[model samples]
Target: MPNPCFSPALAIPAMMAALLCISTGARAELGGTMSSEANSIAAAPQTLLNGALRLRTVTDAGNTTINEYATNTGQIIAYTWQGPTMPDLRALLGRYAGSYLTGAAALAPDGNLHASRVARPDVIVESGGPMRGYAGRAWLPAALPPGVTASDFH
Candidate 1:
């Protein structure tokens, strides 16, 4: 029997509380000891963090932010880094891509995750660290406008 006094506001909070309780009890079954880094990474947005997208990034003098966006599950939206020069962005992402995920994951340096996106790897970015306000090189895809090109697609 449905409660006559139930409201959307009440239902939402109650449902959330129930879900939380269920998940908390199930953690042991999932099987893993918690670590500070793992917790942070898990808690941090898989798509966004502190106003920055996960994979897209822009850097200043002391910090860099990598951000990427997603909707529902599929159809990804990319991020853009503001660069003083195209080459600078390219160099940043070039090093970043080549050194970070690819080296560890051993994947290709595939920049510009989207059809309209552009990225380069300039430095080896650590997977776990203090994010945001970090300076980084710019990233503008493999086929940048005018004179820029990937050069080595081998």
Candidate 2:
């Protein structure tokens, strides 16, 4: 007798669904606490910045190295990334993803499809890269620690 519950046709879809659930659930959004996702990402030991901030670095499955800067109290304030592919902006941007998408959409095409810059009073994101190389940064202006600037992230 064959196993009715084990159809090959259903296997791929089940596996894909499982992967989607795992990826989405494992992300830690910007402007949020980092403990949960940090723990899962094989994070390096947190580094302190003059006692005012902390930096946590992690490399995702795509080999993108992401550096997340946070307040001493654990709120993520900025992120920088570089790798062969771009990281998931929606996951990294958290609540600001909509703003980024909107701002990007409003820009006139500059003939560069792979590059975008979104600047708002509360948030800023800039990214660009070629076929096999990518780099970018996103940050919250008000949340940045005193004496810390956007250039300090990369």
Top candidate when judged by lDDT against the true structure: 2
The TM-score between candidate 1 and the true structure equals 0.19
Clashing pairs in model 2, backbone N/Cα/C closer than 3 A: none
TM-scores, all candidates, are 0.19, 0.78
Tens digit of lDDT per residue, candidate 1, span 9-117?
Answer: 2122222233234312111110112221223223423433332222222233323333322222222232222223111222223223333333333333233121111
lDDT of 2 by residue, 61-87 (tens): 788888888887788898888998667
TM-score of predicted structure 2 = 0.78
Q: Which window of 10 residues has the lowest lDDT sum in candidate 1?
A: 23-32
